[model samples]
Target: MGSSSLSRWLRPEVYPLFAAVGVAVGICGFQLVRNICINPEVRVNKEARAAGILENFTEGERYAEHSLRKFVRNRSPEIMPSINGYFTDPK
Candidate 1:
C-alpha cells in the first residue's frame, strides 16, 4: 500500500464513512445468514404461517432461564460497569 492511499484512508472524515460501510456490510451479512440458516420460517410454507404451526423449540430457547440472563437483565446496560462504578464511586 502506497503512503498516498494510506493517508487518504486515514483521514478523520474517511473513518466514519469506513465505519458506516463496515457496519452496513456486517449487518447485511448477518441478516442474510440468519434468514438462510437460522430462521425456520425460511423453510416453512405460507400455510404453516397461516395455521400458526411452527417449531416449538424456537419459543423455548428464545429466552434463556439461566441465572446469568436474569442477573444481566436487572443490571445496568453498560459496556464496562465495573470501571464506570470505580470512577464514580465516592469511597
Candidate 2:
C-alpha cells in the first residue's frame, strides 16, 4: 500500500483513541485535584465546630498534636530495622 493510503486508513482510527485518552486524563486530573484540595479531617472538624458539637479549639489542637507525635514516633530510628526486615529474607 502507498503511504497516502496507509495514512488515510490510520487517521480515522487514531481520533477516537485520542479522544478516549483525553477523557481518561481529564478524569485523573480531576481526582488528583480533589484529593489534594479536600482534607477530610479538617472538613469534618470545621463542620462539627460550626454545628456547636465541638466544645473548644483545644479539641482540634490536641488531635493535631497527637497525630504529629504519632507520626514522629513512627519515624524514629529504632523502628527502621524492623521495617527494613520485612523486605529481607530470614537468612
Name the top lDDT candidate: 1
Question: Could you give me the TM-score of model 1 versus the true structure?
Answer: 0.49
| Residue 82 error, candidate 2, Å | 59
List model 2 lDDT by residue over 1-91, tens digit each: 6999878757877889979989999999987775555533344445554765435567556645666577777564655777687777476
Per residue, candidate 1 scores C-alpha lDDT tens digits across 56-85 of 675446434445787788779999999999
**What is the TM-score of each predicted model, taking all chains together?**
0.49, 0.34
Model 2's number of clashes is 0
Q: Judged by lDDT against the true structure, how good is candidate 2?
A: 0.66
Model 1 steric clash pairs: none
Error of 1 at 54 (Å): 2.9
Clashing pairs in 2: none
